[model samples]
Target: MASFVFKVIRNAFGIAEHVAPGLCGRAAFELFCRTPNPRSLTAGEQRAVDQAARFMAEARRHCLTTRKGRITVFDFKPQGGTRPLGTILVLHGWRSRTEYMKSVIEGFRDAGYRVVSLDLPGHGQSSGRRLNMALAVDAVRVAGEWFGPFAAVAGHSFGGAVAVNAAVGAVAGIPPLATARLVLISAPSSMPAIFEDFGRFLNLGPRSQLAVAAEVERVTGRRLEDFVGSVQLATVPIPALVIHAPDDREVSADDAKAFARAGDHVRLFWARGLGHRRILFDPEVVSEAVGFVTARPRLARVN
Candidate 1:
């Protein structure tokens, strides 16, 4: 099959690249910064992406240009003459496009909230091929300005990390973006942890890891700790729901625990069997997110 051959070729190349240990570190760093399989949608998947993009575009749509590239945004106002509670911004994770978040989008729509989902730069239909936490945060801020007054933001995986940064940054009065609620699904607590894991997975040496770290710092202008979602959550006063599955193969469930421990305003929920990607599609998970975003507070607390 085509997929099998592709995997074989990729694996062979990977083995050859790692065989020479001296050059392996540098090679690993290159791989670390690059977005592997930049285009992964099959014919059917591509069609789905096209359909979703078209649906979102039927509403108000525009491309916001950033320093790095232009970000495609879809903004849908609420229907049926019922004033929208507020708009909810949804962000997808690494190597994922907004189309993959159909469940979340529909969930918010059914709950009478306007939804805005953008293809982060370097993913989906957006421009660029490399991604870093710092660039992603900047792109979100730009998008927030164009699509002002978000009631809440929900993100999965890497996007969840960005959502945390956006929320905390807004709380800190950086760029003046405001959101009343935050939801993080299967998000990594620490970027450094992910970097180290990637290094081990690729069999990179300590020197290579250091090189990768330096390269990341150079690109993002911030240390790995500065990007950790848990660290940002500690200062975020908005209500947050951290959802994770025990069977998730990528980010650990402990990251959700860290989010919960950061503040009483944050809550942790466990969903079984959804793994990493499916959690975004699970109806129950989407319902929980919708509820959190729309819920009336029992008491008002000043930030």
Candidate 2:
């Protein structure tokens, strides 16, 4: 009876944590970005924007053999003579390809960091036929090696969860733990809640959601609950920037509050207007992220 009561309470809390209203506008915003402007901009302006997008999409499609097997990685390096501020390893969200993170790479490039990213095993150019949360975590673990010690990590949505996993050293085989800074953009802290959300997206009732979740876990050998990638912000000594927008329709804005509860080393940046996908390119966010990572510590004496 005690176990039953605890399970009930746990399930209720999980539901309330990551899922909520405001999802429509988030969906609408994503739709709008893909809607296309249909207006003529200057040739130079269009070329720069489209080329940056192309660099992210086309430049890194080759497969590399890793311990986990042949995995797909999309690596973007800065132009010659562009000294790297640091290395950045990007992880893509569920069902999204590495191309989706072009804005993320763009921000790091502007900061002069070489961005190395992968299509998280089951998505994009990866070889897997099925996408699972654990594979995303696995991709982060193996891919971190390529970025080496001098690196910062960031991700979006499911990818952000993987970043959190990588930062906290939960995903095996990554290194320089306790030293690497982490950036989580619109990350969800709970996994079961997201599955519950997959049901809501289809308007399925409680029973069907639970049933489908169980079946998925059994067939894939990966339980979404088991792969819940929320980082223990309190345990980490490294500085972390957690960014989320309340206007976000995908992941709840309340997650920002949960992250703030992690500890003093964690900084929460909440902006309005930018949706989940487009938030990667928001100029204000780019500035904030660069500033946070590059800022000299208060203890450092200025020359």
Candidate 3:
């Protein structure tokens, strides 16, 4: 049933491409930016969420005002009211909420660092129905201003791309996020590659693809090529840890290698069997990220 519906939509876009490419482009871009509804959590994920609930209950929640809308933010400090080493801002991927990242958040909390996280513009408790990397970056910038100068910023999947862009400061109006370290897990390195994949999925022709690209530029006020993760990461001064599984089906491990090759400051970690989403829950992955975030500057530089 779902396949049939997708085929019908694809054919509609194909026909519309020849009839009214501009209108089709606008509609396609809208679908492209729309956030997917949340899925049922796996048992393991549910268990993690259940365990983190108590920690979340203790967190100080804030509703942050942003250009997109109000975003829900969670500020979790170290247990026992002790002083934190530093704050770590967390961002979840598309279709995921802050709660889905409970395992990672708990790891950070246990490591004695303050953890601040938010639902991207259209996901979780945040407002708006549509989301794009540009809007996500804006939200991060706003959050940085409010609870920033973070010791590190950690993100997964699309959120990882946001972390890179927020750190790169390439967009026209949005300033670079002030952070000392970065963690990008299962992130795509090329924005153009993402668009290409989308175009292939919709069976879009050359004209329709160009039209969609134009719409993206019109909406974001920047060319799609300008947002390549590797390109941006090369210019960022902070050290970054790139984590991805070699067998990840959603995002290529090649992207991770691209990030590592971009600069000496970047370190790549390969999680053998964790795949895309599971990588976030693995104990070793969590430990590696937390350790990287909490490592001393001299030790980090030496590594």
Candidate 4:
């Protein structure tokens, strides 16, 4: 298949191996600090954003664990009713903090599920030299001890890759992350493609793409996109709910459709005009995600 061949070629050239370790860390930090072009934020809109984030910081508790060493988490404990219908582990998109996605965390919780969220390495509470695939998975798995056998794991944008890396594969020999289902919000289909798209967005040159591949390779110990089938994920086998907005400027809807087709268990819900990050706030969007997840029941932890 074309995908398989791409995987082989991607690894051979070290597409993500253009530099020494941790370069992506530096790159990601620089990207995160730059203020996005603010688009018409009414004072009310800004305060609403601030208030929601404030709630999470005040409401959630921190849990730390050691995988690669001391991972930090913001976990919302079940409000003590039937062991929480289920716990939803949430991963935020690139260059965004966990607080910005409060609607997602609150959506799962309001629907009667516990929630665990992390600022992926180099992003939020977790200490990191950089943000890469392996560290991403390591952060989730370490937090897994506190949020074991979750009902489903959900991620948006780049975090979608982290969700897959954690749920379907064994990281550093940590007990395989156990989750019954998956939810990908604006998740991309391939890392090579993600790099290309992001590179174009940032106006990155060939050197930038090469630097990304190199940094990703260091963290994962393999080609960045080689993870296409690292677990059953390249062809997701578990129940997966994919939510994407047609108007997303960051990732292509066609790619999401392609990724959705890879899994028989995947159910795709396309929104007519929701923008990338705004998808989290759309009632119609949240309604679908919460419905899909809550429809599934719970079970005890395996290990």
Candidate 5:
């Protein structure tokens, strides 16, 4: 019943978008950025967002207002430890919050690293209902300022794209955020691929797709191609690990390969049956990612 209602709403909005690409495109774009119910949860689809929220309270919570919008952060410091070995910031994917990343967060915490995760603007407990890649990058920058000098940063899906942008300073007029290492899991390689996927999902005609792209460019003051992870990786010299499964249907495995191939400093890891989101919960993948982020560098710091 709920699924039927959602499809109906989707088709209605899609029709509106098809008829008037200018006005409707802007309105639908806002709705497109609106947070959605977590579609496929591991435990069960019946689990509520409130349940996830309650579970996430295991960590200290903070609310930060950035130039884009307010975002919620979950900070998990190593318990019963004198000093943290290092700090790692986790960025959740579109429509996902810190809670959904419990496995990764717990893995880092158990490894004696302080873990911090944030609910990007328009998602989770963050403020605002509209979001864009530019604003998402801003949220990352703001969070980095608040809890910074991170040894590493990790992100999944859409957040992975933003993390790359943040690291590379791809967003116009913003300086790059520094970090020792980066982990991108199941991320899109290019903004064009994402826009194409969005257009297919909306059943947008070619002309409507172009119109929507123009509107996005107008709003962000950035050419969409400039935000592609593969393109941005060329400017980033940091060590990185890119994880992707062959069966990831949302973002192709080719996307991960493209980003990884862009830089010799980047490494690719394959998690065979985990698919997309499930890879986050796989014990082996979790351990490997934690290990990468927490490993000490053999060389001394420059400064």
Candidate 6:
């Protein structure tokens, strides 16, 4: 049933592309950038959301204004009211809310670090309906300036790409994110690949694909290739961790290797059997991430 629907949509786009490449391209670009409505939570996800609510109840909430719109940030102090070791900023993935990152947030908080996390411009409890890497990077830059000089910045999936770009100053006009370390989980290394994949999914032809890319470039004031995560990570100059599952169906494991190979400053941890989203909740993955964030800076290779 789903395949049939997708085929119908693909054929529609195909016909439209031939009839009016310009309009079809614009439509494709809009659909490509459109943020999907949040999915229905599973029983476990619901519990996580409930626990996150309780966690947020004790947090210091801030509604930050940005060029894109207002965004909500939650500051979670170290557990037990202990003096925080340092502050860590967390970013959630596409179509995901900060609540979904409760495990990671709690891990950092329990480890004596103050954790600050926010919904991106279009996700969760934030403003706006559309989002892209440029807007996301700008949002992170604003957050960094507001609550900055972070001990580390960690992000998952799309958020991970934003973290890398923000950290490396990939987007023009926005200052690089201020942070000491970085962590990326299941992140795509190339923006162009994402567009290519989207085109394939929609069965977009040459003209439509070119049009979508052109529109994206115009909107971002930079080419999609400029947002390559591995290239940016190579210049990060900070100790970084790339955590990924070998069999992640959404993001290829090759992307993870690209990040690890970017530079010796970056290390990759393979979270076998966890796939993509499940990795966020895995106890071992959380422990490894927390330990890296809390530990003193050093180069450690993980096999």
Reference-based TM-score of each model? 0.82, 0.68, 0.92, 0.73, 0.85, 0.92
In candidate 6, where is summed lDDT lowest over 10 consecutive residues? 294-303
Q: Give the C-alpha miss distance for residue 262 in model 1, angstroms.
A: 1.2
User: Could you tell me the lDDT of residue 22 within candidate 5?
Assistant: 73
Those runs of model 2 whose alpha carbons end farther than 4 Å from true positions after fitting are: 1-53, 57-62, 66-69, 171-179, 199-231, 296-303
In Å, residue 233's CA in model 5 sits off its true spot by 0.5
Per-candidate alpha-carbon RMSD to the true structure = 5.0, 10.9, 2.8, 9.1, 4.9, 2.2
Worst 10 residues of 4 by lDDT: 294-303
Per-residue CA lDDT of model 4 for 218-241, tens digit only, reads 556666666652234644487777
Q: What is the lDDT, from 0 to 100, of the residue 47 in candidate 2?
A: 57
The residue pairs in collision within model 1 are none
By TM-score, the better pick of 3 and 4 is: 3
Candidate 1 residue-wise lDDT, 133-177, digit = tens: 656777888878877678888899988988887776622224535
The runs of at least 3 residues in candidate 4 whose Cα sits more than 4 Å from the true structure, single-residue gaps closed, are 1-49, 63-70, 79-82, 170-175, 197-215, 229-236, 296-303
Which residue pairs of candidate 2 clash?
none
lDDT (CA) per prediction:
0.75, 0.62, 0.85, 0.67, 0.78, 0.85
Cα RMSD, model 1: 5.0
Task: Kindly report the root-mean-square deviation of model 5 from the true structure over all alpha carbons.
Answer: 4.9
What are the per-residue Cα lDDT tens digits for candidate 5 across 126-158? 888767787888888888898887888899999
User: How many residue pairs clash in all the candidates, one count each?
Assistant: 0, 0, 0, 5, 0, 0
